[model samples]
Each structure stands twice: as structure tokens, then as C-alpha cells.
Target: METLETLSDKLDTTGDIQSIVRTMKALSAVSIRQYEQAADAVASYAKTIDMGLTAILHDRRAGGLSLPHTGSTDADVAGLIVIGSDRGLCGRYNETVARAAVDCINDRTAVLGVIGARAAARLEAQRHKADRLFLLPGSVAGMTPMVGRVIVEIESWMRERGVETVNVVHNRREGRSRAVPTSSAVLPIASEDLQQLADARWPGPGLPFFRMDRDRLLSWLVRERLFVLLYRALAEALASEHATRLAAMQSAERNIKERREDLTSDYRRKRQETITREMLDVISGFEAVSGSDD
Candidate 1:
């Protein structure tokens, strides 16, 4: 029942919305690429660190030194880091991560650290409180500082809060335009994983050799490993966030286009009806005037 003017105004508004959706889609695509590249670089560095640890562990075993007990058998308090999106419009990106984080707690006394305000709100709604809230980095360049801050917080939790095991929950990019929630232990690098790394075949012709004390070298490598893990996780989470947003924006664009088409069709049909009615009235008047003249 909308008039021509109303239809025109609706079309204009829809056009504006379509423009915004397209802009968001472009930004999401660009962000996904940036974060994916960063994640790839971090993954490469992590492999190198793993190789270093492997060589050091192999040498330590040859020297009859006992391997360091990395994982704690009895963790009195655990720390959980939940990585989520800062902004909405990403279609359950934050909610999925929050649910995974809550599942990870599973009735344990845990210190919770959350990234992104939207995620924190979700957690709060689920009756969980964050011990600390961290803001997500705005760009690739900002990630380093954010990672450093997270590392500092982790160290504090270990040193002052009696937290032993630290776990991270985040969304990882699945296939194109999909994100899956995943969780991994970040601290006390599992001994089994370390053993696997030590058993891995070296790619180079020469075996890795370090000139520093084995324990000291292992400590340095562990720190680097932690850094790489956190950095890579953050990158992956950001990429997944963008991918989800891109998908949502694509859906929005499709709906907007359909709505615009429907509006256009309605406007055209109504205008044609009005013109037909006006022509019919003019013909009738002409016939009446001709009859009167006759």
C-alpha cells in the first residue's frame, strides 16, 4: 500500500545500507588476509623454535640429564584466556568462543582473562566474571604490543597468583568463511609434545648445536615457544573473526539486493497503474465531449 514517494524513500535507504554492507565486506576481506599472513609467519617461527628444542633435548638425553618436568601434576589454580572479537556484526563469533571458554572451566577454580568487550559481556551473561579484560589489537602492527602485555599477565599469574596451568580458548579459521572454536594449553608445554618434537627428523644436513648451558638454553627456548604460541593464536583468532564477519556481510548484501529489487518492482508497477488510470479518465472525457458536440 506504499505510495510512490514512500517507495522512493525506501529505495534510497536500502541503497545506503547496501553501500555500508559492501564496505564492511571489503574491510573484512582485507583484514582476513593480513591476519592470515601474520599467522603463517608466526607458525614458521614456531617450527624453528621446535627444532631448537628438539636438538637441545636430544643432547640432554645423551648427557644423562633428566628432562625438566614442564607440566604440573596438580594445578591448584588454572588461568584461562578467551580470545573473542571486540565488535559485533560477526554472527556469533564472540558467543561461540565464550561458550568454549565456559566449557573449558568445567567447575574448576580458574582465573579468567578475556579479550574483546563483546566477549566479556557474553561471559558475564553466563554468570562468569573476567579477572582481567584485554582489548583486541586494531591492526597487525598492534599485535606485538598486545602479545607482550598478555605475556606479562601470564607471568604475573604464575608468579603471584599460584596459577600453574594456562589454557587458551579461541576461534580458528576453518575452510573459507568459517570459524571453529578450539582450545589448547599454553603453559607447562606438555612433555609428550616436547618428546614428539625431539623425535622429529631434522630437515638440515647438520644437527642443531647450542653453545649455551642446556638448562638456560631450554628456558630461553620455552619462553620463545610461549611467545610464538600466543602470537599465532591471536593471529588465528583475528583471522577467524574477519572471516565470520565477511560471511555475515555477504549474506547481508544478498538480502539487501533482493529487497531493493522487490522495491523497484513494486514502484514500477504502481507508477504504471497510475498512468493507466489517468489515460482512461482522459479518454472517457473526450468521448463525452464529442457526444455533446454531435
Candidate 2:
């Protein structure tokens, strides 16, 4: 029932909307590439760290170097770091992470740290209050700073609350253009992994010796391990965010194209009908004038 002028206006509006959606899709694609590259770069460092740890632990077995501390933390309390998207354009990204986080929180006394606005909102809606709310980086370049801040916060919680175990929950890149929610223990290094490394042989052959005090070197390596874990987790989460956004934008582009086609067809039909009606009016008026003259 829309007039020709109205249809024309709608067509123009839809065209503008489609342009904006396409631009967003293009930006999402670029972001995905950048994040993926960053993730790959960090992944290499992580691999190196793992190799160093394996060597150090193998040496420790021969030298009888034990951890300086008993590696015992308060058993009753724990901490969870929940990573979610700051923005909401990507469909269900925040919700999925939030749900996974809630499921991971089996203890009522566990402290929760939320990163990103959308995640905090979802937790709040569930009547769960976050002990701390951290902001996500606005760009890929800011990831290091954010990770550093998070590490400091986690340390503070450990000191102040005697939190024993720290776990991280986030979405990790799966297959091509897909992300899956994952939860992992990040602190107090799982005993099983440590035992496995302890029993395993070093890859190269000859036993390597460290120049520094064995305990000090081990402590430094442990810190490096923790840093790498946090850094890699943040990088993975960012990559997953970009992937989700890219998928969402691609879906939006498809819907927009379909909508534009429908609008274009409707406009053409309405314009043709308007022209035919005008022609019929002119013919009737000409016939009336001819009859009068006769």
C-alpha cells in the first residue's frame, strides 16, 4: 500500500544500510587477520617456554632441586577469571562465555573476576556480583598492557584472599572461522603435568646446567610459565572474538543482500504500476475531449 515516493525513499535508505553493513564486514575481516597473526606470534613464545620448563624439570630431577615453597595454597577458596567481549554486535558471544563461566563456578565462596562489559552485565543479570571488573583492550596493540594489569590483579587477590587455584574461562579458536568455549587451570600448575615432565627425558641428549642458583632459576621459570599462560589465553580470546564478529558480519551481509533484492523488486513493480495508471488517465481524458468535439 506504499506510494511510489515512499517506496523510493525506502530503497534509498536500504541501500545506505547495505553499504554500512558491508563496511563493517570488511573491518571484521581485517581484525580477524590481525588477531590471528598475534596469536600465532605468541604461540611460538609459548612453545619455547614449554621447552625450557621441560629441560629445567628434567635437571631438577637429577639435582634434587625442589620448589622453594610447599606449593600449597588455601584449599577452601579459589578464583576464576572470566573473559568476555566488551561489545555486543557479535551474536551470543558474551552469553555463551558467561554461561560457561557460571557453570565452571561450582563453589559459592569462589571469587570471580570479569573482563568486558557485556560479560559483567550477564553475570549481574544472573544475580552474581563480580569481585573485580577488568576492561578489555580497544585494539590488538593494547593486549599486552591488559594482560599485565590482569596479572597484577590476580596476584593481589592471591595475597589478600589467599586464593589457592586460579582458572580462566574464555572462547578459543577451533576449526576454520569457529570458536569454542574452554576453561583451564592457570595457577599452581597441575600436578599431573609436572609429574609427566619430571619423568620425561630432555629432547637434545646432553644434560644442560644452569649458572644461577637452582631454586632461583626454577622460580623465574615458573613465573615465565604463568606469564606465558596468561598472555596466550588473552591472545586466544581476542582471536576468538574477531572470528565470532566476522561470522556475525558475514551473516548480516547475506541478510542485507536478500533484503535489498526484495526492496528493489518491490520498487520496480510500484513504479511501473504508477506509470501505467497515469497513462490510463491521459487516454481517458483524450477520448472524452474527442467525443465532445464530435
Candidate 3:
């Protein structure tokens, strides 16, 4: 029979442990959907803008206008953006990004725009100055307006700071800590990346003789392409973030389970020891009475 004391201790441990695991589970569930919505919005731009960019490239070459590449990278004043989790349960999610940020642009002069509080904290710990740190609202819808605002802010920051390049650091994973610390340039766009976009098959076959005013179409195409590139970056970082969170939660859940089992086993052992001692005491007491009567 398990003693009340032992059982109580086991209950306390289980309750405390379960609470943490439950919180982690809820966090994972919430983060997953947020990533999905953000991803969908960002990914859609790839489809909408890629074809138009291709047309622009083809026409530009035929004419003599050299459209500036959106994918090319350069180092002058650098802009670094890191996206990490606001809540922790996902071990190493914030650390991985933070370290990568440190490795790449941890310099004091580099301007930082951090997306999560945890990441911002880490950067601050390392004494990195953050010009802007963003904590995304819960839902992707909340993030929509933020997208443009952030872009504008980053643009303004880069110009004011004389930043020539922008790099983003985030965890990339579908699940597990398999997250790769990724760095993507956000400034002076890479021409090669843009050229790849130019190659994507867009709907409406290239008209054998496409009819349109070249200048108007070209300007519109450039704007759309820029939007697409920025959107893609945000989407990819978010997907990676979700995967990291889920993996961390799952791992935490497992650890709690193991710890609970160990504590329960210990409690049971202690309870049995107490019960056996009580039985021996009773027997000894009866024997002593019998001896006295004799």
C-alpha cells in the first residue's frame, strides 16, 4: 500500500511537470498555424511576380535597359534581421539564430531588426545594438500590415545608416532541431536570384508578339518582383521557426514523461517501505503483549 505522504509527493511532481508540457503543447499548436498563414501569403507572391520578372528580363536584354538585380549582395553598412521565438520551450531555436547572427553580423555597428523577444534578448546580451526589433502579432493577418511597415522601416534604416546589405538569420526546419542557421541577403538584390525568378513559368503563354507599353509594364514588374522576393524570405523564415518550435515541444514533452516516471517509481518504492515498517510494528506490538501476559 502506498503511504499518503509518498502518493502526495508523486502527485505534486506530476502536476508541476504536466503543466509545463501542456503549455509547450499549446505553444507548438499555435505557432504552427501562424507559420502556415504567413507562409501562404508570402509564397503567393512568388507565383504572382515571377512570370512578370521573366518578361522584364527578356525585354530588357532585347532593348538596352539594365534592370538592377534584386538578389545580388554587397557589404557596406549592413542590415541584419533575426527571427526567433517570443516564447521558449523550443530549445536552441533562439540560440541557433542568435549564434548565427553573432557569427555573421554581430558587429556593434551593424543595424539589427529582431523579430522575437527572445532573439532580441540574446542579441542584447551580446551587446549588439538593435535599431528595430519586431514582435509579430499572433496571427498572420496581424502580420500583413506589418510587412509593409517593416519593409519601409528597413529601407529607411538602411539609407540613414548607410547600410549597403541586409541579411536575415532564422531557424530553418520542418521538424526537429534539424534547423539550419540560414542567412539571406535583403539588399542590393542578387541578380542571380532574380534571374531564376525570371525563368519561372507564368500563366498566359508569352505572346508570340506580346503587346504592351514597355516602360509601364517594366516599372510594374519591378515593384511586384521586389514584393515577391521580400515575401518569400519572410515565409521561409516562418516555416523554419514553426518546425523548430514543434520539435522543441515534442522533446520537452518526452523529457517530462521520463522525469515523471522516475519520480513515480521512487514514490512507489518509498510507500512500500513505509507500509512494511508499519506491518512489522503491529506484529511486534502484539507479540510484546502476549509475552507480558505469559
Best by lDDT: 1
Least accurate 10 contiguous residues by lDDT in model 2: 66-75
Residue 91's lDDT within candidate 3 is 64
Candidate 3 per-residue lDDT over residues 1-294, each given as its tens digit? 656676777779777877876786676667766666666776666665556667666667667767644432545567777877687656677888889988887343367788888889988899875678787556556665656766777768755877667677777664444777877765655777666755555456662345777776765665455455555555556666666666766777788788777777878788788799999999999999999999
Clashes of each: 0, 0, 8
TM-score of each: 0.90, 0.90, 0.76
Q: Order candidates by lDDT, high to low.
A: 1, 2, 3
User: Could you give the candidate ranking by TM-score, starting with the highest?
Assistant: 1, 2, 3
Compared with the true structure, what per-residue lDDT tens digits does model 2 show for residues 59-94? 766667752342544467788998888876777888
**lDDT digits (tens) for residues 87-127 of candidate 1:** 88999898899999889886454689998899999999998
Error (Å) of candidate 2 at residue 268 is 1.0
Candidate 2: C-alpha RMSD to true structure equals: 2.4
Q: State model 1's lDDT.
A: 0.89
At residue 136, give the lDDT of candidate 1.
Answer: 99
Among all windows of ten consecutive residues in candidate 1, which has the lowest summed lDDT? 65-74
Q: What residue runs in model 2 are displaced by over 4 Å at the alpha carbon?
A: 67-74, 203-213
